[model samples]
Target: MNAKVRLGEFLLTRRSQLRPEDLGIPDYGERRRVPGLRREELASLAGVSVSYYTRLEQGQSLNASPQVLDAIARALRLEEAERLHLHNLARSSAADPGRRRSPAPERVTEATRQLLEALAHVPAILTGRRSDVLAWNRLGHALFAGHLDPGAPERPAQRPNMARLVFLDAHTRDLYADWPAKARAVVGHLRLVAGRHPDDTALHALVGELSAKSADFASMWADHRVMACTVATYRMRHPLVGPLTVTQQTLSQDPSLGQNIVVATTEADSPARTTLALLDQVTPQHGPARPTVRAGSG
Candidate 1:
């Protein structure tokens, strides 16, 4: 993810979605080559010169001021996630071109492992930047990826990726009731992560692999949507548990690692809760007997 190119693409994608009338501007019914606001119109709305905005959009400008970026964000009608993504792109673009840093290790802390063990009653898993399952509780494995080997996450070379599973794995695809919506949300969140970690080589590789393998992923990737998955409800058709609705809550333990603890829950005394309890009864009470793991690229 080249930051300059990403910034330009983000701006272009967002700009192409808005129409003149949508921004309270008069439409003279001029035949324009592109949809949405023209460069001059966007610049005017953002309180900037057309030439300057053109330079920015062309990836020829760096060091965009915070005020200018904020103005452009408002002009584009960007949501909170999109606005943050734009700022992240701008910041990454301005970073020294020759500067380099080693990729941060994606490892679950011992403390987090303990927490995962403590939260034994709930379906929970830990995921890193590329949505690779770093670790998972017993119920999480049974609830989400029971078809795959339960010990996959322990093996670095074969770690299961949530996005890849959703888009490429047959079992995962069959698990969701609203597969398209789930796929879109996955791609959207990945866009936000890509903007924030522009230099992540592994992330680039993951995106490239998914784009090559899944037509759905390729299409969604091209959309350039940005989203953050803090909390979401999903309907799943588990082979063992039948239909269940789970509300997933994502919590961050370390910002620098870009890892999250994802825990799934159901409404009290609901059918989904009963189904989850049944699932618990079928699975082992203790954690997986083995510690095998899986990786996204493996």
Candidate 2:
């Protein structure tokens, strides 16, 4: 959780990935002893002394400036998200003692709910930081968790996670036609979440449970893979309906709950769209009303 250690691990991981030629470093046979750029090479690239870089990598250095972090990030070729994570790790290191940062509260704001209502035609749901289903449009329930209790409002305690459903729930397993692809995404998403919320107790608990209960999940989790998934397309086989080519987009609500709003939409005039519309029409009439009083707005 400490910045220096996180930075070191990140640098180590990234360094192991690039070869000498990849960074224009001459590599004569017997000139290299390790797989990645050495500490000296990395320090040279970042315009830092070998001793300083070594100390940082060993978690002995603290309070790394943003400028130094940027240099290191560039040296390691970190992505934007990774760079941000690096900054977060560094900045959080200097947190004042006795200061407790409560977990970021998650909720569905009135405006967000209105937006969902407006996009009622699309299958959309708002999820918390832990991937807890917070709220869903009528079609969203049908598209994703149609079998769950529609009457039960999406909340932190009662909400079913998309990752849990994809990997842990048998009903969800059967719901996805291309289960393997969906499974990879689930793990990748979890990886991304873990990287961001390394201190999230609930997230760690979820990961531990999934790793213990599901062998497939355990296998993927060991790979140490991380990815930021904002959009994806998938082929899903709905039991009530049939195959669907759906595109998933994740929206973040700022100054609210930071909840991720994921919406799945089919191609224009596609059978899936028609099926979704039909589902929306039939679901509310047949099932109980979806509970609205779930999260505390405050």
Candidate 3:
């Protein structure tokens, strides 16, 4: 969606989620036409006129100042991530489309490949901003996507998107013991990315495709939640190695490149750790021997 429309929808959705009682506003007995706070109520709370806030919410006003956006965010009780997203949307909505640069095709640099090789014993997958699998080490491939072709990430056209896998691929869906939590995290992070890169055609296309194909994804997307996929603990039901708990931590490779390295680790000397070690041993060594590495996929 365009930045203006996205900003409007986000504002409307968040407005609908709050009640007058949520912010200590006394409600008199009266018939209501819709849910949550009205535009007048929100405008009053944000210290703006109703007409201005209405214009903003209707996508007619795109030049909101940072102070005004911050005020609106405070009135809506937005979290840190959601507040950042609000500012991003507002900026994009005001930006000239002709001046925006098209995103470059994402690639894993040699330096990144060397880092992956250094973490060969650990489960590590490199992913792009839109959650596309750029590359992975042996254990990383086995832990996350052993069902798919091990070399799929080597080809851009064949790269697996983490969001798509979580919602649309049965194997990935089954891998997570608490599937709903994983699904929400993926959607939330995707929402944040969408706000940040409003001009990203491929990213928007992926969102549209997933929304059309999966009811679950559509519902989650409509919720307008935002999250950073920094560190999360998940229980995985690996087909070969059975159940194991691991903490997945995402490390940014480069902010300008919009690539991140996701590493999965288990607790020290735990059964999960032993299971991971077993998985490492059983996972075939692809290409050249690790530590000296060869090009591969996730």
TM-score for all predictions? 0.95, 0.81, 0.93
How high a TM-score does candidate 3 get?
Answer: 0.93
Over the stretch 205-276, how does candidate 3's per-residue lDDT look in tens digits?
A: 999999999999999999998988889999999999999999999998988867899999999999999999
lDDT sort, best first: 3, 1, 2
Cα lDDT over the full model 1 = 0.90
How far in Å is the alpha carbon of 187 misplaced in model 2? 4.4
lDDT of 2 by residue, 31-129 (tens): 666788888998999999999888877877778889998998889877776677667666655555456455766766789778877886788887777
Best by TM-score: 1
Overall local distance difference test of candidate 2: 0.75
1 or 2, greater by TM-score: 1
List, residue by residue over 91-143, the lDDT tens digit for candidate 1.
99889968868676788788999998898889999999999999999999998
Better of 1 and 3 by TM-score: 1
Give me the displacement of residue 198 in model 3, in angstroms.
0.9
RMSD of each candidate?
Answer: 3.9, 3.8, 3.4
Candidate 2: worst-modelled 10 consecutive residues by lDDT: 285-294
